[model samples]
Target chain A: MPIHYPNGRRFHETNTKKRSPAPKKISYSNRGMTLEEDLNETNRYYLEHGLAVIHKKPTPVQIVSVDYPKRSAAVIKEAYFKQASTTDFNGVYQGKYIDFEAKETKNKTSFPLSNFHDHQVVHMQKVIEQNGISFVILRFTQTEEIYLLDSRFLISYYQNMDTTRKSIRKSDIEKNGHLIKMGFHPRVDYLKIVDSVYFSN
Target chain B: MPIHYPNGRRFHETNTKKRSPAPKKISYSNRGMTLEEDLNETNRYYLEHGLAVIHKKPTPVQIVSVDYPKRSAAVIKEAYFKQASTTDFNGVYQGKYIDFEAKETKNKTSFPLSNFHDHQVVHMQKVIEQNGISFVILRFTQTEEIYLLDSRFLISYYQNMDTTRKSIRKSDIEKNGHLIKMGFHPRVDYLKIVDSVYFSN
Candidate 1:
């Protein structure tokens, strides 16, 4: 069944074992792009044009096995996470600190609250307390439609995780999130909204 | 013979591998208490107490191997770096972004510039272009003294790699950088300088 979000977009559903898309649609890596790759390229474009400065926060890895085949370079053999992180990208946009996580989901019905981690919610809350702007950029894999959801809504739902309401309906995301238009050079040009909301300059 | 840094701190000539003196020194399954561990704890304390906020930039790693134990969890099997990273930590402090690399050296005499990768210097330059503050924190393992050297100094010498003056002299860092007084709570209390420089209010 085609999953319909109240906001209007329809999400196509499928079960695949790999990170790569099955046969018909786009394969994340085959487009010669991972989410990080696209954003990094986008950030470079932004940096060059003097539009805005942003970057992917490095993935925190706890490396365990290292092989010193030579004296110069060492290779990681094993590793694990110290803990869950807050987000993937964060930086200054027009004098205000901006933080966010970018995620892609294949679920047609709803973007599962399970997609959002507990620690990430905590991180966003701390950002709010410090008066920083935090949000999540969510993309429905089937439709390739992307939306930016404010971290406030995310945090509120996160706190009520124990309550009757758990998963945020797809309709809510489409309504609350600012729809970001996809572009050619940067792919996802999100700073357009930043200028409208945070800078106003 | 012990490595002779112009700074007065002394590392033992014998490589007995003396246990770190502080009882609270970080030691979990990972590589003892990493430079990241101390900085993170420090950043958190800084945040809770209204001290300057700092965060370690995730290390940019290339994933060559990944194993899916189950559909629920993705296990990374192997990874490497496409290129070196700029530094470990960068974030906003008092309406200004703060960026820096933290390193600990057993050599009492001086820090080896080899510890820093080339791309990191380039990263700092980019951050500076955006009017961000960039720096390096050098910990003399023998003395456990933490010094914050502004990126300007590191950049000037880093650029002159073709000529002499590759590694920064300990004496130069001691004179130019702010000597951070290590404390019980924060481990490395760097926010004191941030407060003086950015947030006097």
Candidate 2:
């Protein structure tokens, strides 16, 4: 069996064992964390703290061939990536069906609508129809700002994109979206925003 | 870039095109349907009919190497399967979170507990703790009987395996579990059982 980092990097326990241990470095700011990594860490924190049960769905792959060796594990010989049919992360949060996709863009002013595929948008719509708490975690990488925007707003914007701007303006996001505060323990505390935005009475 | 059947079989468009056109085979009575195939078909039906939004999570894989050629899609050079930490199927139905794992056993007398992993059992416990509906779909292939057993019962049976029987008896399941009726459109009408067991007053 193999383990992978949240960024899809392969983890090598043997390599780690061969290296000389060094003191861990501490950082005050969210400098090198990718949105996926932050979310995975946050979900792990939530799971460990008994706050939520969320997981990033595995990358969809279309396996073409596999080799079953004489005395070893079956090895995937040929495979290709498949476009996901649904959002990346989903699970139960406070007895509610929580579903969302996380995306990051380098744009400073607007988040491009092209970042999401049609199927994902449609899937989010369906989840919302089923009364699931559906949203998107958008990160403006240029400014290191993250926002949780409801899927309802995204779907409405996506549907009317032919006449309007191809991207969502930052001002609109700031007004409509909830900012996710960065933290050390969980890294991206989006659920805190979720509680206020979706759960607050 | 490639398509796949519910059984993880690769779909070859070229091969399919080259084959002589033949009428599709028709069958009844759930003669050869695996539990996974049934669940996948049922989920597709639910999705298409706007009934619910359930999906089987993709098998987790850890890619060790990738070959990105100048042209064409990148192929996975080396990859290994990773053990899943959560149940296979999950989504929202009628404003409720639904999570379950489907399994089929060849044994006629009892359903073995070894079919589930400790992590999966723990995950189901967590789901139940969070007030999410959790269960397992057990199929006795010998008799073609399918039962939807709640996670609470399964967890208790699993945890007390040391002192009691290592498997749940067929009679016990017949008494405690709700039978899932076979169908044509959705194949296995498990949600009907879900509604009666988890939703109905």
Candidate whose TM-score is highest: 2
Docking class of 1: incorrect
Model 2 residue A35 distance off true place after TM-score fit, in angstroms: 0.3
lDDT for A139 in candidate 1 is 76
TM-score of each: 0.76, 0.87
- Candidate 2 TM-score, C-alpha based: 0.87
Off by over 4 Å in 1: A1-36, A70-72, A80-83, A107-110, A161-164, B1-37, B47-53, B70-77, B81-83, B106-112
Model 1 TM-score on chain A: 0.77
Cα lDDT tens digits, model 1, A29-144, are 32523454456777888877866567776555555555545444445555443344667787766555678888777776577677788778877777766677788888777766
* Candidate 1 displacement at residue A138 in angstroms: 1.8
Colliding pairs, model 1: A58-B58, A64-A78, A65-A77, A65-A78, B5-B109, B62-B80, B86-B120
How far out, in Å, is residue A168 in model 1? Answer: 3.0
Stretches > 4 Å off in candidate 2: A1-29, B1-31
Cα misplacement distance, residue A65 of candidate 2 (Å): 0.6
- lDDT value for candidate 2? 0.80
